[model samples]
Target: MTHIRKAVFPVAGLGTRFLPATKSVPKELLPLVDRPLIQYAVDEARAAGIEEFIFVSAPGKTALEDYFCAHAALERQLADKGKTDLIERLAPTRMPEAALTIIRQDMPRGLGHAVSLARRLVGDEPFAVLLPDDVIRAPKAALAQMVQAHARTGGHMVATMQVPRAQVSAYGILDCDEDAARGRLLRARGLVEKPRPECAPSTQAVIGRYILMPDIFDRLERQGPGAGGEIQLTDAINADVETVGVTGYAFDGERFDCGSIQGFVEATLAFALDRPELAAGLRARIDRLAGNDRFAA
Candidate 1:
């Protein structure tokens, strides 16, 4: 069993969608509720037993790097004030001093390019790739589930979700043999990046989570700029389809596309409702807002 001790987080993209707000702050640091978007991804990866966290970052993403580092002053302040609960909550954000590696992606090439940046750090092992933009809520972390699937199947594993056919073009669509067991795992035949609806292989879309073998670096190295004239990760994965075998695990979860405005709002509300302390209050406020005549338009 190849132990997946490392996980790569590609956070190099300039978030044009969030615009003005993302202008100064790294979009990964943007809060879904109280926690930053990247924190959720990190938590999921941590739960999956990942030991070393590798962040592929861009020039302007200093805050994203700082997020995982300890804030000594703040920790001291909380400790001195007897805020044990607050300090305990901060434990997840702190990594063992040597466990984090931040690599720079100098250009905005694409997701594949960003992932390739981590090749040296992840050499010769199966590792996971998590896109912080997609925040998933589930009983078990989605990547944790995918890791277990990879342990059993010994191949490339990607987290998948069934999106509506109309929305197929927005994601990397998987071409796969349907599982007779009707379980989460699907044997992938191929993958396409943002294909038109009529040309789509299936309505099953690949989400942000992926557990890949090290040889994927070889495919990504030879890959050319695709789709939007940027190297597409889907293309690289497809390149290895025949040789390594790719599997899509339909992860049990609800994914929130925090990279988009609507999805960010949805994730915020969904997480808020899950908190028992805030559920009733948030529900009352939501009901009041819905009943407001001003919002009816």
Candidate 2:
């Protein structure tokens, strides 16, 4: 099996959900504690043996590229101050600078269109698509799990999780053949993008991680808008699954939907508690706030 060396991150949309905070800053650069949201996704891809990084970005996103680039002046300043420890932290992200590339989406066409734009860059090779908004914390990185599954299955793989029945319509719902047995992989029958609650086949929603074959570009090119006026990635994936088949990896991970405000707060809290350096201070602050609110009440 060929090792999947590239990963694409579609980050061009205007973060209307985040409003003023994202007005000047891209949402991917938002902090999940000390690291930006994009860094978590990058770390996962790196863990999965992805050597090339392709970021589909737009204006005001130079900072995103810069985040992964070496800061010569900053490194020198840290070194001169005898701050070798601080400099070490920035070293890894700077290595193999050529491994990174940025492409512009230019408009908010849709997820499928954003991915289609990468076809020329990913010609004839399998690639991973990781949505930074889905900040997954797991024993095994979600994309890595999908990559391993794809090697065996040799088809498209999408990371999935069971959502509440009522919440199914809010996600890209999957229709699976029940006769299919369960394992590390699954064969998807069809896919629906934001289907109505009554119309959705199963609550097994597509969580933002995918390992796609290059053939998806052909599907996306002709895929039209199903729900909104913009093309949907689910439609293209679903179209391909009819013949290519899709494996739903019920990924072993605590999935955080950082695409929304509540989800972002939840991810921040979960990630912070796991950190040895930040946990104690954050715990104390939380305890003090709870006590103060109780006293006032």
Candidate 3:
């Protein structure tokens, strides 16, 4: 069994939805509370024992790369100022010099194409891919749970969540057979991207986390443009349903879709409230706002 030592982060998306703010700063760098979105994803991956980090980035994403880079001058300044707490806070952001790899994806193809670009670095090992847009808050890191599941069953594994029937079309719906023995585990028979609600096979939807085998590289390479003339990763995974086999694990977590404005605001408040320092102030504000009928509407 290949331990999931490496993790891939697809950060090449332009984040057109955020527009002006993302135009200058990579959306992954946008702060949820104080830490950037990408930082949270990296922290989660680290908790799962992922040793190497690979980022699929685009031209304007230099800020994302720099965020992980060492800032020696700033560190020295903090030390001189006796700001030990600040230094410790920044410690988690540092990575060993050789542990990070960034691959540039010039064209805004699709998730499949972006993932395929990492083939040279990922090589033959089964690796994990995390989309930073989905910020999941859970007792145990979501990827860690999936990694544990992969240890039991050696095929590809993806994190799934039960979405409302009406919202099924917004995600990659999993067509699965329930594992009688393991309640949360599902044997993925197929995957459909943004299918009509009536056409959805199951309410279980594929989220941003994926632990996939190396064979998926070949599948994505051979898969032509799908849906919106862009290669879809779901299409590649679906193609290998019979051969490679895919499994879905319904993760225990609250997933916030940071890709949308509403979700972003909600996630900010959720994460802020999670911190011991911010909970009281935020909760009081929430109470005050709830009292205002105009705000309620």
Please write out the lDDT profile of model 3 over residues 176-221, one tens digit for every residue. 7654427778988899888899999889989999999999999998
Error of 3 at 31 (Å): 0.4
Alpha-carbon local distance difference test for all models: 0.89, 0.86, 0.91
Off by over 4 Å in 3: 179-181
TM-score-superior candidate, 2 or 3: 3
Q: What's each prediction's TM-score?
A: 0.96, 0.94, 0.97
Q: Give candidate 2's whole-model lDDT.
A: 0.86
Give the per-residue lDDT digits (tens) of candidate 2, residues 95-123.
Answer: 48488889998878888888998998888
Candidate 2: stretches off by over 4 Å = 177-179, 292-297
Please provide, for model 1 over 52-111, each residue's C-alpha lDDT reduced to its tens digit, 9 standing for 90 to 100: 999999886888767888999999999999999999888888889789999998988888
| Model 2 residue 228 CA deviation in Å | 1.3
Largest TM-score belongs to which candidate?
3
Number of the top-ranking candidate, with lDDT as the measure: 3
Clashing pairs in 3: none
**Candidate 2 — which pairs collide?**
none
